[model samples]
Target: MKLSPSVTIEQSETGLEFIKVASEFCDATIFLQGAQITEFTPTGKKPLLWVSQQEDYQEGKGVRGGIPICWPWFGVSQHEGWPAHGVARTGLWRAEQVKEEENSIYISLSLPMNQIDEKYWPHKTKLLVEFILSTSLEVRLTTTNLDSETLNFTQALHTYFPTPAIEETKVDGLQGSKYIEFGEGPFEQHDLVSFARETDMVYTQAQDTQRIITPDGIIEVSRENSRSCVLWNPWIDKSKRLSNFADDEYHVMLCLEAANVLEDSVELAPGDKHTLATSLRWV
Candidate 1:
C-alpha cells in the first residue's frame, strides 16, 4: 500500500489508523475511527470536503458540531467512558482492503475483536465501514451481530459543509416538519427555531435525503438507514479557538447529519445484519 507522507498511518488488528494529519486540503487523511474523513481537497472544479469534525472533540473546533454517530444515547450514554457516542468511533480499527477505483479510492476498515465488544454490548458485533471517493463522496457502514443477543445502536454521517458565507446557504430535504431547536445560547431553549446562530435541531420523520445549497454549488445528501437528521452551525465566537478552522469558519459552513438514534435506533439480532449508507454528490 502506498502511504501519503501528509498523514501518519498505523496498522491495527481491526483496521487502519491515522494518527496525525498535517497536509493541505489536497493531501488529506482518513482514520479507522468510524472510517472518518479528516480532510478533503478537491482539485480543479472539485470541492474540498472535511468529514464531520464532530467526531474529534475540542472545546470549540468548527461549526461542524459533531460527526453524527449515536449509540445507546446521542452524546454520552449512561455508560459514560463508553461515551454516549460509543467507543467504536474513537477505537482503532484495521484496514482490511484498499482498491483504486475509476475516479477515486475505495478503502475499507473493520472492527478488531468481537470479544472486546462484550463489555458494553452483550452481543458479538462486527462493523465494516467503507469510504468511496469519486465525483463526490460515499460512506457505507454495516453492522453484523453474531451473538444471540440483539444489538441496539444509533448513528449519523455528520457532515460539515463549507461555503463562502452562511447567509448564502439554505438546507433542503427537511422543509415540511418542525424540529427540536436548541437555541443560540449554550443548551438554551428547546423551542423550534429557524436556522440561525448556534442551533442544535433534529428533524424527525424526514425524507430519505436532503440538500444544502450554496452560492458556489450544492451538496446532496441521501441515506438508506438514517431516520433522524440534525442540522447545526455553532455561529458567533465559537469558531476562534479551533486549531484548523479559521476565525469566521461558522460564516462558511453548515452541519447536516445523517443520523439514526434515540427513537430511531436500529436493532440487530444474532446473525442479522443492517446496512446504512450516505452519498455526498456535489453539483
Candidate 2:
C-alpha cells in the first residue's frame, strides 16, 4: 500500500497504532485498533469532529470521539456482561487497501470473525470499513454474511460533532420522524431539535439527511441504506461518570449518529452483504 505523502502511520504514547492524514484540504487520524477516526479538520475551518481532550489512547479501549463503528448491535447487549456497542469498536482490524487520489485519500480495513470472540458474535461475518477523506469525510461500513443461514444485526456510524456550545446547537430535518428516548413514548418531532438537558433519542423512519447547526457553520450529514438514527448527549451528571471524557466536554459535543436500530435492524441471507454509509461536510 503506497500511501499519499500526507498520510503516515504513527503510534500513540500508549503504543496504540493509527494512520494520520495531513493533506492540503484537511487533517485526520484513524486508529487501527477499532478503525476509529478520531479527528477531522478542513483547512481554514473549525473541526468537524470532536474528540475528548481527556481521552486515554490506550490499547483495547474505544477513543472518546470520532466515528465509532457500532456493529452486530447498537446498544445494550442482549446477553449479560458483553461489551456495549459490540466488539467491533475494540477489535483490531487490518488495513487491506489504501489509495490516494488527487483530492482525497481512501483506506479500507477489514475485520474477520477470527479476530473477535465467538461469545460476543457467533457468526461467520466479514466487516469492512472504507474511509474517504478529502474536503469532507465519508465512511462506508459493509457487512458480509459468510454463514449459510440468515443473520440479523443493528449498527451505526456513531459520529460525534463539535459545537461552540451544546445549548446553542440545533439539529434540523427530523421534524416528521418518530423517536423514543429514555424508555419514553415514540413522540413525533414537530420542530427542529434543541438541547437543554441530557438527550438520548432513537429515531425511526428518518429522512436520509440532516443538518447540524453550530456556531461555526452548518454541517450536513447524509446517509444511505439507513432508516433509523440516534441522537445523544450525556449532559452534566452522566458526563461525569463516563470514562475518558471530561465532565464539561458534553457542553461542546453532540452525536447525531447514522444508524439502523429498532424495527429497522438488518437481516441478511446467506452470502448476502449490506452497506451502511454516511457523509459529512461543512457548508
Candidate 3:
C-alpha cells in the first residue's frame, strides 16, 4: 500500500475531503483548514465528541483537535520509544478500501509495516479503523491480533465538548460514580464536586452512557462494552499554551473522553474479539 498515494483525491472548496474505505464499514470527513472534523455522522450523532479546532498542533508545538484516539498509551509517555503520544496518530493512514451508498459512506484505513516501526511492537497486526459517517459519526477501531497471543492495550475516545463556560458546565453521566484525581494540588479536597476550575479526573466502572450539557450545546455520549469515563478541560493557563486554542478557548471546547485504561485495561484473547464503541448526538 502506498503511504501517500498518487491516486486522484478531490476536496470541497473548503478543503474538506470525505473518504469511504472499501471492504470496511467506515467513513470520515477531513477538514483541511485546521485538520479539524466538522462532522462525523457516525451511527447516529451520539459520539460527535471532539470540538472543531479547539486545539491544534503547531509544527514546533503539540497536537490539538479532531477526535484523537488515545491508544496503547494515553497522554504523555508511559513506555519507551513511544513519544508523548503514539506515532500512529502523526502518521498518515492509507485508504485501502471504500464502500459508498446514497445515505452513508464507509471508509477503512490501515497502517502497514512499511509505514510503522514494527520493532517497537513485535506482533504482526493490522490497525483497522472504520468511520461510519451519516447523521452521526460512528468510529470502530479493530486491532487484528495477528499474533497467536493476547494483546494488552489501553484506549480512549478523547471527545472534546464545546461549552459556553467551564464553571456552568456539568457532565451528567457519572453523577454517583467513583473517581480518582491524577493531577497535582489537593485534588481530593476541592475536586470531588462537579465542574469547576481546571477539572481533570478519571471515573472507573462508569455507566454505559454519559451526558454533557453546556450552554453552547447538549451532547449525549453513549458506549457499548465500556468500563470507564475520563473527563478533562484546561480552563485558564493550559488553554493559552495550546497553539490553536485562544485565551478563552475553554468556553468552546470540553473533553469528555470514553476510555478503557489503567486498572481497566483490555485483554484480547488470541483470535478473540473485543470491541469498544461510543456515539454522540447534539441536542
Q: Estimated TM-score per prediction?
A: 0.75, 0.97, 0.76
- lDDT string, candidate 1, 59-169, tens digits: 212223323333434655766466546655655567777655445666677767642455776556777887765556677878888777877777776666677778767
Runs in model 2 deviating more than 4 A are: none
Q: Candidate 3's error at 194, in angstroms? A: 4.3
Q: Using TM-score as the measure, what is the rank order of every candidate, best first?
A: 2, 3, 1
Candidate 3 regions with alpha-carbon error over 4 angstroms: 1-28, 31-38, 41-63, 183-194
Model 1 TM-score (2 dp) = 0.75
Regions of model 1 farther than 4 Å from truth = 1-28, 46-48, 51-73, 114-118, 183-194, 237-247
Displacement of residue 230 (Cα, Å) in model 1 is 1.2
Per-residue lDDT, model 3, residue 21, is: 23
lDDT of each: 0.62, 0.91, 0.59
Q: What global local distance difference test value does model 2 have? A: 0.91
* RMSD each, Å: 6.2, 1.2, 5.9
